[model samples]
Target: MQILANIIPYFISQVENFSRRERISFAYLSIENVLGFSKSDCILKNDFKINKKDIKSLINIVNQLKKNVPIQYIFEETIFYNLKFKLNKSTLIPRNETEELVKWVLQYKFNSLFDIGTGSGCIPISIAKNSNSIISALDISLDALEIAKINAMYHNVKVDFICDDIFSYIPKRKYDIIISNPPYVLKSEKVFMSKHVLDHEPHSALFVDDSNPIIFYERIIKLSSDYLNDNGMLFFEINEKYSGDIIKILSKYNFVDIELKKDINDRDRMIKAVMK
Candidate 1:
């Protein structure tokens, strides 16, 4: 039998790659995930005994953390929009900035929605959990779509998950809202990203060619014109560096009421345009 307090120090000592702060966060997250002990529980009941089997599981989690594996992938689930979403190496971990995008989308009223590049189906599924909407999502990877399907089923939300390349797939129906958090990170920007993301997450869901960074944006915007109903809305989680370019593309497509929104980090990470 090991006490919670003893196990945390062992995690800090074993996971040498993370910073002190990250190690601490990993410690708390691991303890809670393995033992169902909240941070307060860990502090107040510091003497809480962790049995040998649970301690072994926590050690395995810590070893994976040392390799810069994201805790979400290690746990195979994460909280998005206050809902638990299942994940795997096939899917990118959902970001808080995406939650901001969902919040912005929910501020409007719409009956039908479509999500492009719906990794883990977080975007459309989160919306489905919150609203009475006909939601559909598409992804290029069958593995990713399978994970998305599991997540939608787990949440008991109805989302039509399609496996198809967006650049080639033609829309079969129009939607009241077309939203995407497409891959917008430039290959050049990879140098700035953390090792955990670069090493663990799917590249197709993250990086874009530097010469054509907004390729996904262009295709989605072009398709939106045909797939959106009159006065329908298009929302994107954008790369701030390409915000100006995206705005130009939207304007060229005759989209109106275009707006760029900053995330909590104050980066221009989300944008919206209305079909004209």
Candidate 2:
């Protein structure tokens, strides 16, 4: 029966099973979503009372968090590149590493761009918002494409979304830039990933066969050459473990200026190359 004004400390006490970091994150989200307050408000008004109606909502959210549902899934929306994007089980949630990939791409100039496996269209939509380049993005899941379409429309950016398998997709025209954050997780690596990610996010967008960790990278790199204008770039948010494997594949396929980059975590998570 504790009022909203005292919810943070009470919630923290309730979520003792979660790590301190997780507890803090949940507290912040509770204030923002449950109490309809900003992060700053949580600091300025620690004793802000919660309305009776939202108490049930807060309890539900906390319960879901206890079950390991990602906060993004609970909210059904997230911020990427400072732009808001809609989310669902159909698409992979955007990650900070992917944001680094977008930042890397933004460093270069291009006229036309394409994103394969464009889950929720976060990659292309974010790039389009920052650049004047014409953008086209594709995902095999029609459900995922719809979410992407919603985000594109929400941001008022025109991204041509196509629902088709990339292996069979033949581009109508070449592009100056082609990028993808395709399935790179080894099937065996599932245990290493968080349960929330394994259970909630679309698995097809995440995993590849353990025997072929770079399958999508190989296919996307080969297909990109056909679509890429000469000296144009191909960028990937990569698997850190496959840095050598990825580099070898790109070299065999005649790519140059191949470089591997790390995420904000300083983990090797991205790679870039050019069609030679």
Candidate 3:
């Protein structure tokens, strides 16, 4: 008879190279995925014996974790605004700061909405689930748009997903609200990010030239005048360092009621401007 190996010790050893938080997360995900157990079940059965057949697969997952592959991509999904979004190497994983931006918009009502750089369709899909709004989402990468479309369909939200470069693209119909979380990270700022992001995530989705950190902002703001209805609103998730610069650009475009808001970390992360 084969001896059943105890789960806890092996799980700990496999995730030893990870951080404390990562260790916990990897263990939780592994046990849940392998055993079809919930987080609560993971704890309750921490000592549960595992089938030796599963050990090799768990080791592979742990090795990937050791290499700093983001669990979201490895799992091929992530939760955004309490909704599931399928992930891919081509799209940026939606962040909590974005969820805060979504929450801020949910406080106001709008009939038509447009999302710029809709990587995973997280922004528009989340809003569509809660609000009955006509939403349009655009991405520069067709590969990213494919993943976004999958997410939109999975959520059963009707969004007009477009694949085009926003720098040259123009909208035919004006929208009541425009929102974007464009590529704000500067090339010089790559040192500040983790290996998982810098190595695995799409650079086109994460970075812009340092000389023009807000290049996308400039293009989108200039294009906004043509696509925003009277009294329309524009919202942005900005790099904290460029918050003031973004506000000035919006003001230069004659947008009024400009406000800069911070995320939970107290970093300036959001800005809102209204058409006069």
Per-residue error for 139 in candidate 1, Å, reads: 0.3
Each model's number of backbone clashes? 0, 3, 0
RMSD of each: 1.4, 1.6, 2.1
Query: Compared with the true structure, what per-residue lDDT tens digits does model 1 show for residues 1-53?
Result: 28988877887788888888888888888888889999999889999887889
TM-score of each: 0.96, 0.94, 0.94
Considering TM-score, which of the candidate structures 1 and 3 is the better prediction for this target? 1
Sort the predicted structures by lDDT, highest score first: 1, 2, 3
Tell me, by lDDT, which candidate is best: 1
Worst 10 residues of 1 by lDDT: 1-10
Alpha-carbon runs more than 4 Å astray in model 1? none
- C-alpha lDDT values of all predictions: 0.92, 0.87, 0.86
Please give the distance, in angstroms, between residue 5's alpha carbon in candidate 3 and its true position after superposition: 8.9
lDDT of 2 by residue, 39-109 (tens): 77766876666667788788888788778888899899889989899999998899988988999999999
Candidate achieving the largest TM-score:
1
> For model 3, what is the error of residue 251's alpha carbon versus the real structure, in angstroms, after optimal superposition?
1.0
Tell me the spans in candidate 3 whose CA falls farther than 4 Å from its real position: 1-8
Residues 1-276, model 3: lDDT tens digits: 011224445556766556777676667777666667777775665556667666776777777877888888888889899898999999999999999999999999899999999999999999999999999999999999999999988988899999999988989799999999999888988888778889899999988998899999998888886789999999999998988888888989999999888899999899999998
lDDT of 1 at 156: 91
